[model samples]
Target: MFRFLITLTGLLGALGVGVAAWSSHGLPAFVPAEQLPLALERARAASLHHMLHTLALLGVALWCRQRPGLWLNLAGTLFTLGILGFAGGIYLLRIIAGINEGPLIYVVPLGGFCLMFGWLALIVAGWQDSGAPQKHD
Candidate 1:
């Protein structure tokens, strides 16, 4: 599981960087002059979330190396799903043009929710693995 997480993290991290670079340097070429601003904005937003969550995934992977738990595994899974749904949705919507009004619209928000839940899961994992039970009287 540790190796799997690390490998996934590496792949996603590279994808995030690639998307960021593409958004900044290559997106303009594909987007129309009038639509470029909105396209660029969406691309940038996707790239930002992608890169941030990829880092979070890396942290989770590293944490798993020392201590693995249900919540930690769930967090990693959610983060990976979130990146694919959120970033991938935006990229599709912006790049595909006519499909903006399609069902893909829901994917971005769903991904955002997953990302938020992943953080909550991390919090749970941290508390669970804090080492030693605390006494409150």
Candidate 2:
């Protein structure tokens, strides 16, 4: 579990950087000037989610090293799900083949919800941990 989260963090970070670079450089050439702004906007949104969730996953991995709680684990799982569903769906919807609406469209809001739930779970864990005594090593 520990190694998986760390590995996922690294992979997600790399993917985020690659996609960001592609959005900045390659996407402009492929999209028309008039439609460039919208395309770039969605790409930027997806890139932001990917990068931010990568950090969250890293934090969860590090947190698990000290103490692996259920909420913490849940947060990590949801973060992973959110990244796949949210960013993946966005890329498929906007970037690939320019298909605006598709079956994956349902996944977008669910992904966003997952991301929110992930954060909420993290917050709950933090609050619970704060109420408990800390063990200094």
Candidate 3:
């Protein structure tokens, strides 16, 4: 279980790094040579990062059976939701004007709060699991 968490975390960390690098350098290959940096930043941070983080949370959630793992996974999931709701809403509103999502943007803060609670739960679960005394038969 620990190994699984480590592996998923590593993947997320690696993805974050790759995204940072790509946003800094690789976007020009796809975008027109004339677009401003702000547009690119918005796309990379809110769009690309949102997608990557969502996938990372999903991967982590696959191992959510153990207590600590579940909390960590939940936290990751909430954070992913926050990104999708908050950043993603704005992205969609800007890029997909015809699709009326309405006041779903109001849910963004709730998602953010969930993300924070998830992290706190993860920390507490970790401490409880680690600090428990092992039983001997």
Which ranges in model 1 have alpha carbons more than 4 Å from their true place?
Answer: 130-137
Worst 10 residues of 3 by lDDT: 91-100
lDDT of 1 by residue, 43-72 (tens): 888988998999999999888877877899
Cα lDDT for residue 11, candidate 2: 91
TM-score of each: 0.89, 0.87, 0.46
lDDT of 3 at 110: 61
Instruction: Give the per-residue lDDT of model 3 (tens digit) for 3-48.
Output: 5545655665565566556656766665465553654666565656
Candidate that beats the other on TM-score, 1 or 3, i.e. the better one: 1
Q: Supply the TM-score for candidate 1.
A: 0.89
Q: Candidate 2 lDDT (Cα, whole model)?
A: 0.85
Instruction: List where candidate 2 sits over 4 angstroms from the true fold.
Output: 130-137
- lDDT of every model, 2 decimals: 0.85, 0.85, 0.54
